[model samples]
Target chain A: MSDEKKLAIIATKGTLDWGYPPFILASTAAALGYETQVFFTFYGLQLVRKKLDLKVSPLGNPGMPMPMGMDKWFPVLGTALPGMESVMSSMMKKKMRDKGVASLQELRDLCFEAEVKMIACQMTVDLFDFNPADFVDGLEFGGAATFFEFAGESDICLFI
Target chain B: MAAFDQELDATGLNCPLPILRAKKTLSGMEAGQVLRIVATDPGSVKDFEAFSKQTGNELLESGEEAGKFVFLLKKA
Candidate 1:
């Protein structure tokens, strides 16, 4: 791939753990002067929604660090217990906030300030019964063709 | 602390935040200006290296002092 300083990110997951990568990378790419676009598809539609404020599911996400003092087999512990995902999600958010890491909403706002193009998948939005008003302004709506048009011109295409 | 045209205290921020702040700070600076950024994230060492390489900015020096990572970047 050539060093064209452009990045196309395909965001297909909506969990808090998965949410950070696309927004984080997109904002970072814009900061580094890259033309950045993040296309949210499939289950990723939740992120574009206004203030759904999704949580992390420790049962399925292995990358999330075990909450302080929790066992390494936290997922197993979560499996043994119900509503553990909310607990895990809160602890993770607290840890991240205390560590000075920007929150998901903060990162998303930063992306908007950076002028990174955000696209919502048309099929997913239609399937989910979400209208353009359900999302914030300055977003483009299109299907796979829109994403493909962006990916075709970029030097780096990341699927996260 | 070093002599720099601009200084960004990215202390306490992790990973991409430090880099993003540094990039924002450097964007307003003129070419050849040196920026000193203090970051607490351990990953910033390699991240800055790659960022400089990709963006054509110059990394004049980088080191850990007093438990914080310090980076000197010149706007390219």
Candidate 2:
């Protein structure tokens, strides 16, 4: 509308697999010279947590394919396993590293360097008992009103 | 004259970086300039092609050389 493209990325998932979509899209939008904002809410707040790397494992997810077995026959064992998410996250990270994709930390740093705005949803932070210190520096804390204000002028709005 | 000459070595950089760098460099140049980008990432080939099409830039020459990709772009 203002001859400048705007993009808003809503991050709602905290899993490792779910973490990539928002960062990737936001980074790409910023690289394209668009006004890009990434709003972290709900479990997605874990992505911005300084201590949590947000890893996921492929095993135990009913949605994930088992190595050589049919997923449907694998039983409910998929969701019952502990630490599968982290394992999957590590595996995915390894795969990306092998293929030369930038690490999540690198991507975050690059996004900041490129001037992508990052916002943390206050409601989720309160619900999760997370403090501002838990997140990376330069993250703004706001509510739905703030998100709507930012998203009102966006040409692209995505929830990932 | 040979249009213009620019070189970009984006080897080992993945998608978006190469495209981002190229876009940044191209934005600073005048039209009709030629930019040569060298990259090793396979995804960059398609990424640059799409970038060229989307940005209205021209892909004058694109080929592979000894495991490296070479792209010649003309700013439009």
Among all candidates shown, the one with the greatest lDDT: 1
Collision pairs in model 2: A56-A85, A56-A89, A57-A84, A57-A85, A57-A88, A58-A88, A60-A78
| Model 1: colliding residue pairs | none
Error of 1 at B45 (Å): 1.0
Off-target runs (Cα >4 Å) in candidate 1 are A1-3, A60-65, A68-82
Provide i-RMS per model in Å. Answer: 1.1, 2.2
How close is every model to the real structure, measured as TM-score?
A: 0.89, 0.80
lDDT tens readout by residue for model 1, A1-160:
3554789999999898889999999998898788899999988877877776888876654555675647654546554477787887888889999989898888898899899999999898889787779887888898888898879999899998
